[model samples]
Target: MALTLYIDTARWRAHQQSVVQQFPGIVPVCKGNGYGFGHERLADEAARFGSDILAVGTTYEAARIKDFFSGDLLVLTPFRLGEEPVPLPDRAIRSVSSVEGVRGLVGARVVIEVMSTMKRHGISEEDLPKLHAAIEDVRLEGFAIHLPLDRTDGSDAVQEVAGWMDRLNAARLPLHTMFVSHLKADELARLRQQYPQTRFRARIGTRLWLGDHDATQYRGAVLDVTRVTKGDRFGYRQQKAPGDGHLVVVAGGTSHGVGLEAPKTMNGMMPRAKGAARAGLATMNRNLSPFVWAGKQRWFAEPPHMQVSILFVPGDAPAPQVGDELVAHLRHTTTQFDRMLDH
Candidate 1:
């Protein structure tokens, strides 16, 4: 009846525990659909993981999960002036990346983010002195550095983090704890070895929850199945069927993040060519669906509707009956499931 996310609870929990054990002082990041588990659910899981600090993407998210987590909330987004006011608990630690941000959040527990190679947010190195001066009124928790995912430029994350530590030491700033992102376990270990005094807590999300792909499965329940001839017109746009087959209506559509995809970075020439081909096909309204039938991904009869998708199951293949569940390959971060069942 719905698009459901089924979890192998035992395997999933085992993976989580393994990650927690691997990364000492790991701050479980519960943000942005909670990596497909929802924020409140992740909050409870973080509690079960015995994490003292939970990192959320925004202050409003911190406020939402406060009752469920009962631990310190670290807001990753830098707090800016004149932002929508949200009543957050005292345990919410604001991340301030600029002098103005520090001044704006006076008396609030704060983490100063230094500009990383990513260049997304954070105070520049030259502004470290100014930020140091502005943080007198606020409770400075520590510093944070968000590293870029691609290290293809030969830039080592461990070395980069060490360079920041050196800069902080030279600037006479506190180096008690440094929260970092996008660092591998070995990189984190090297940092700990280099700076034995500083506690480096990796803010992990995807690796912690979605590390084991085999532990989770997505299924779209078959709502209806109608047989059609080769030239039969069907669907909203009255598109002609490519051949004789069964039109399988599955319970997942645009609302469930079906038929939607994030922009992919097509780096090489072959990828760009493939992108062009996909675009060319899209113009003709001939697109592939994510729904898998009989171990094969089926084609969409037309663009998916709001609550259901029509997959063309060719006559040569076995057609699924109504009430059956079709496996769907979906991006967890983008998907909104009707239910998450744990076995």
Candidate 2:
């Protein structure tokens, strides 16, 4: 009677163990809906994995999962002045990207983030000296750099990381530890070989929990089924049926992140053209739903409601019974499931 996430528990745990083995010092990231597993669940998993540190997106997230994970919490979002005071300051290692941030979090555990090519956050190289001078009062855990995922611009992530290492060395800053993201296994290995003194811990989220594609499944239970003919009015907006079909009320909707799309990066011309075609179809009320019945994705009768979606299954296709579950292709990061079953 709900949108459920079913997990192959053994396989999922095996994948997590493999990731931990691949990245010797990995910081499991549990933030932003906890990658659809919730903060406490991932925090417990991190504890089970024996991780000494867990990375979260914000101080608020750290506070939420602090009790669940008994290790140090690394807040990836840089702490700024006048922000809400961090909870459990002793166990929280804040990421500081500015001199003011360093000054603001004086006497707190902090990691100084140097700006990378991503340019989202972090202190610039020009201000490295100022950052160096400002970190005297805080417990400087180490440095961190968030790398860009797209490497098509001829810029190598390893080179970028090494460049920062060289700059930090020149600045006479501590080179004991570095936290990095988006580095491949071989790239991390090369960096480790280049700098034997530094311990590089990769902060990973998606690849760690969602690495095994076969280890998870999503299903939406059929709540009701109504046979309809062409021109039959239905749904909240009284939308007419386009053809003979069965209107399926599935137990998933806007509240569960159904019929919602996050902004995507369309790199190639073909992708951009296809995206435009999808948008054009959506404007004409031909939007498709994620629920798959009889091995085909069905069309949405209308926009999803708060707790249910109506899918139009054409007459030719076999319709699901009220108790049957329809397999759904969903983006786990954005989805909020009512229940998770471990098998």
Candidate 3:
């Protein structure tokens, strides 16, 4: 039973070409399980795109991908003081997001990320002086700001960035380069103009790596197909097949980040009943289906388990045989796949 992302080679090549042509000097971000295809493969692909540098999520993540790529690897995760088994990958740039981290990164090439949307890391406006003094012995390579997602109002983004710039200006930090995450080209251009002295690096994962929606597809293979009676029991929960048809088993299940849950918003609408005794009805139908099968856009099944998922392949339509492949909308971060082959 294998769950995989089968890459259409021609489509992938076209995607790469389009990306490179659009964005020059792109830093391919290979992080968080490489968004499904694994870090090393993403690195190899990034090299083909002619990316001068690559960004990894953590120091440990960097170790695995360092050999796969020849370009400079920058670690986005922070380095703590007392965390044992510290990762020190050669030819890698580390991001120091805290005063302590900056102090610890003495003599190391570090990127300072002023994190927005989360107040977890980075040297604050008040603490920058202390950080500067602590890192006086070390060479400060550059500064970076991890941008947040834009809001409906668009004021949070502007305010946070302005505050970050104010802090940087107050500290008089000699920043040679800056890296921004989740920023648009126009937004980045505006920032660059404001801070004309520094070089800006856009650390993109979603756009740079998995840019096009239809460029690549995630498919699951039908391992077993058996006709089950309506009363017959199946699955972990002993769920009986609704109708008399082939019970198609796919290569996805709970262990692969499937069957997991998430939060949702409620509209809180109350329907008014016309003339029957009572008067009002409040219905709460908040069922969430994260995945859909191929061809049938409206039809959807629940998240699959680690290595298997069950989909209702209609008998009226073309039925799949054993070992038949079907498309799956995969949550890339949660899945540990068998392999990905370029077709």
TM-score of every candidate: 0.98, 0.98, 0.83
lDDT of 3 by residue, 207-249 (tens): 7657776767766677877776666677666765556666677
- Relative to the true structure, candidate 2 reaches a TM of 0.98
Q: lDDT tens digits, residues 199-302, model 1?
A: 99999999999999999999999999999989999988898988998999999999999998999977889999999998999898879899998889998999
Model 3: residue 8 alpha-carbon error in angstroms: 2.7
Judge candidate 3 at residue 245 and give its lDDT.
62
Clash pairs detected, candidate 1: none
Enumerate residue pairs that collide in model 2.
none
Cα lDDT of candidate 3 equals 0.68
lDDT of 3 at 88: 57
Candidate 1 scores a C-alpha RMSD against the true structure in Å of 1.0
